[model samples]
Target: MEESSALPRISAVDLFCGAGGLTHGLVRSGITVRAGIDVDPACRYPYEANNSAEFIEKDVNELSAADLRPHFPDGDISLLAGCAPCQPFSTYSRAGRSKKRGLDWQLVNSFGGLIRDLQPTLVTMENVPQLADHPVFQEFLSTLAGYAVTWSIVECSKLGIPQTRRRLVLLASKLGHEGLAMPEALGSRRTVRQTIAKLPPLEAGQQYAADPLHIASSLSETNLRRIRASKPGGTWRDWDPELLAECHRKATGTTYPSVYGRMEWDAPAPTMTTQCFGYGNGRFGHPEQDRAISLREAAMIQTFPRRYKFVKNGDPVRFNTLGRLIGNAVPVRLGEVIGKTLIAHVSASRGATGAGSGNAQNTLF
Candidate 1:
């Protein structure tokens, strides 16, 4: 086996990089991310400020290989990585909808198109697990004709992330590596208490002066009372008849019991969604505090550093904007796993002929 110092140097570019979560992880695993590309101008500050990578603010569809080649340094192993938007493939999306519709699929095809044009030595992608069953994923797979490919549904908690997110991860190598795999599960699962119990407490409508992102959204008078009565890991069924919403009073409403609930301190948090800051959102209430989780807490659950800055100084912290960025981000811990796996795969394939010489799965935890 080759030593750590013997591993090939890798340079990468991130597509659809929101606030630089995946880039940050890859950097931690010793990959040089030259740039991140996205359409949202709002992502530029945090992406460049934290990741030390250039932020190209443009739609991915319009970008060509000529526009990207300059970023990759000569003689380095080239890597192309990103998480294209996956909301249309989400379980919450309309069921049984035709796979042939929407701009989301178009964005995914744009990614495949880049791979065809550039032919990077390595590639990685992350998205919702449901993407595995969609036709769009098969279409994306067809683009890698000469590459060896492997993919799986990765559980975030098993990777030491504090959230219960399951993602579809894909790895492909054009360098003749076989059976390239995702990283093995770590020692233990992280819990909500271990992740966020030490932050200063806040009321429903309060903001912490020390950390602006610690601000919680305001609750209505009835919501305040409802939260007070809510028990850890318990549902709104614990509420009194008068406190129940009109939806909850209906027979069909009982089906969605996870809404308006408190998180269990010992358990992993439910997946963070775009509306994660709202009290009425699914299982978002703090276990002890009488409010929803703050933006900092949400980012932390996604394995982002607490000091990760989403906005500039003097800029007002808006709940909707920050929530979307945090929720849509790839968990940084999972990204590290991808980076480690790729490093091991590339190292193991160095002397082999169209077959892997070692098991990369059990190598790193």
Candidate 2:
């Protein structure tokens, strides 16, 4: 197929950008991200290093319209995109606490506040699906009085993400009445084996020789023994009686088989979490390898391009930091789908009238 002409010159500011996954996808789909803001300083190096965008290390709450005014000065099709921290709405959060406080939830509301104040032409937010039911979500929708809003709980795999993750996506526009819908499911879901089966074999705690990004975390001797007993697509029940954890001996542990489990090569992988690099975290083990998935593998499964850089030379490689960046990001492919949908909507709107209607298309895939 012949390459299309240069994409539209629209600019965007990504809030709460974790290592630029969504930004990367938007760029690939032809949107120019001018700057990215996140509280985590670690995000600065990787995000700025990888994308053609500036990175701001500042808390969203501390920001005001003036701080963002320069980025959207043209008032043309300026876009605001964010994926706030989802711990507050996560099912994994501990249930029933007397003191109900969530800074993350506040941060999302602040994101809404930014939208209300900045009044960007296009706005998009992605979060864990449960957020769709939160009262705060309703308030967020209400806050966008002039903008047309559309949202959905979408399966990431349906958008070609190669994992079973799901998220709630909201897109609102200031120009006309339209809503953004999920993109059409791509071909058969990409499988775990299809994603990483071809990499050179490495031992349980080994890093690849040629590629630094191909490094895998080391496994403890006890974990190594446990991995040896683990079976692909099987649970701890497959292990010898002596190898079982004390927790597993209890009734509650029986249902947690997805943990310390190997992936099935033929199926899509389980949702990649912040601790996915650890062997005992979840079903993060390699399909056939005796090790948990590597950082590169995790990024790839998160739909980051193989060439995407995550660290600078001489920087310490911290598993927690890297994992959080990978797990918390909007999958690059999903961002592309959102980007394309927005582009098509803008194009159609611009064609219908000489004005750029900021509305998003509502055609569900």
Best candidate per TM-score, number?
Answer: 1
Writing each residue's lDDT as its tens digit, candidate 2 over 87-141 gives 7555443222102324667877888899889888888898888887788888888
How displaced is residue 314 in candidate 1, in Å?
1.1
Q: Which pairs clash in model 1?
A: none
- Report the number of the highest-lDDT candidate: 1
Cα displacement (angstroms), candidate 2, residue 149, comes to 0.8
Q: lDDT of model 1 at residue 288?
A: 97
Off by over 4 Å in 1: 1-5, 91-102, 351-364
lDDT for 365 in candidate 2 is: 33
Q: Residue by residue across 22-76, what tens digits does model 1's lDDT show? A: 9988877767889999877778888987887899988888889889899888888
